[model samples]
Target: MSAKPWPEGTGCRILQEVDSTNAEAQRLAPTLSGPEWILAHRQTTGRGRRGRPWANPVGNFTATLVMQPGETPDKVALRSFVASLALFDAFVAATGRVALFALKWPNDVLLNGGKVAGILLESAGAGGTLSHFCIGIGVNLVAAPSRSDVDESAITPVDLQSETGARVTPEEFLDLLAPAFADWEAQFSTYGFAPIRQAWLNRAAKIGEVITARTGKESVVGTFETIDDTGALVLKTASGRRVISAAEVFF
Candidate 1:
């Protein structure tokens, strides 16, 4: 991997195969002196939100960024939005198309209204302060799983190659992504989540439409309002505005 595009104090390792980049990042976090990245060409045991199996076939982008954010859990959680914006920018730069891509609430990248990428965040800390965080990202580059391979209610998967008719290798995607992420991270560090939130709102998937937010126990159906100050999804129900920190959103 080329080191020129990466941020200062960032270290990276590329592996041909791994059980999961996040797991590897966890093992390295305690010993890391600075920000580090772990990239896997193939992940045998990758996972998504709620421990769902993540398919990391060869040629897809599978990587984990491990860093010590040194912030409160609420602030650290905002990285998901930051990462999503970076991913959106990177995909647009790689494909040179801005119309087909949108960012789902919280942290999923949609291509032509289909799920093309997902973000998973894991952290270890105590007393509301984060010691380290692992931001695991997976993007479908060459191929996407069939509808039968995923949950029936989940959005159909889409791949970059199929949508753009241009071959995009994982390496090339990461090269574009690394610099984009650094740019957003710098913005987040300087201006806080307000700027990031506004940027996210601009590319949000269904801002004014009614959507369903399933939070495991119950479901809330309401108009998709803006995200709140703390990065919660604000939904306008008949009763009032409801904020959700985590849930499965369906449009």
Candidate 2:
């Protein structure tokens, strides 16, 4: 009857305040298109997986790209690496150097010894039915939240390479990420996800090393195997192969 209040297409919308990009994405659901909307500047309500409160600060790069409809929900796990790649490109482009970015399983981006970027995807619709996915990304650009506030260790681009005498601004970072999604989205649709899976593993940290994994109820130490073709992180368990859809990994 009336126009639904949502952003149109091809550009990312910046917001100064919101509960969370993922949450806002939920609100925009039931009527979403691939306009690639983002609400990041400050999130009064931020979230990590499994109800963990993410420390989302202002003046950083945080966004939620609303994916197109009709894709199966479970398959969206494959999209996580695409988001990771987008952030990785932004990291390298900003710093103008190689090896400046790395992945920490499922979806955390690490720079130096601390965190610089995080990727979150939320679904809106029935499990087996057609659905839209919101890919939320947070990249620290300027200031850092209090170290004491971080549940686990975290770092930012500024914390690592600020000595370069030229800092990457939020605008510049977002500019890089927008075109990145455009490029990666094409690859994801045409070739499925094998290429991205390989690329992610190549840049993945501790792929062959044993690491600690926390999945809310239990914490297990296991050797990190490569990500399977299905996009689930494979851990070589003592019993056999254990595929993880979501977990907080640490070294």
Candidate 3:
């Protein structure tokens, strides 16, 4: 129902009967910059990292952003926290309470003990002069897919059941998300990950508790030590300190 292109630095939105927002964003990243450069009405094949499919039914916010700066991939790892902070703030605005928002590592937003949103970042080109990159975001606003469509237990904005039991709109969510995302992106761009790390830990689900992590061929339970300068999830192991590159964790 939004009539005009949202007047923001990153508000390059278009309507499609259905197209994967991630793909659309990647296809457009070489051009647009900032906040939300691409968004899809319905995603036929929205994907997450590791070949997971991101649910993109109507009404949920399925968007992607183009991130470009003078940093290497390793240096810009803080983007995860920045993106999470944006969704966290959006959750607070939606429910008028911050207690329901929590982070599940790198970039997953949990609500009421269920996944409400996730972020997927990918690169293009190489080196510091990268062509462009895309950060795909999927939020379960109107409906949550069945277990078969999601890797984790399902959740829906309908859980809020807004008096009419109708779904939440993408517009309503984007209205709150854009400003919050811009704010956090500004912080991450200005400062570094140190401050964001503390903010992230404040809402992190498994900060001081034992969590299960599945890296590749092994799975272990350990206390999450901390996120180092480069954004690696450090786990204190019995043998020694182990910093993991990628893993599926549960608390």
Question: Considering every candidate listed, which one attains the maximal TM-score?
Answer: 1
- Which of the two, 2 or 3, has more TM-score? 3
Ranking of predictions according to lDDT = 1, 2, 3
> Which ten contiguous residues of candidate 1 have the minimum total lDDT?
1-10
Point to the candidate with the largest lDDT. 1
Q: Could you tell me which 10 consecutive residues in candidate 3 have the lowest summed lDDT?
A: 155-164
Model 2 per-residue lDDT tens digits across residues 1-251? 11112222664677788888888876776565555667577888788766777775555666787766567776665788988887777677667765766788888888765677777777766648646778887766766556676664333333433433346666667777777666776788888898888888888988888887778778777889888888777888887778876677878
lDDT of 2 at 204: 91
TM-score ranking from best candidate downward: 1, 3, 2
Error of 1 at 233 (Å): 0.7
Supply the global lDDT for candidate 2: 0.71
For model 1, residues 110-226, the per-residue Cα lDDT tens digits are 999999999999999888888899999999998899999998888899998898886878777777788888999999999999999999999999999999999998899999989
Which sections of candidate 3 miss by over 4 Å? Answer: 1-8, 33-36, 148-167
For each candidate, what is the lDDT? 0.90, 0.71, 0.71
Query: lDDT score, residue 228, model 2?
Result: 82
> On residues 100-214, what C-alpha lDDT tens digit does candidate 3 reach at each position?
6688887888877677788998767664556666777888776666666544523332233332243457766676777777787767777877788888888887687777778
RMSD to the hidden true structure, all candidates: 1.8, 5.6, 3.7
In candidate 3, how many Å is residue 179 off? Answer: 1.0
Error of 1 at 67 (Å): 0.4
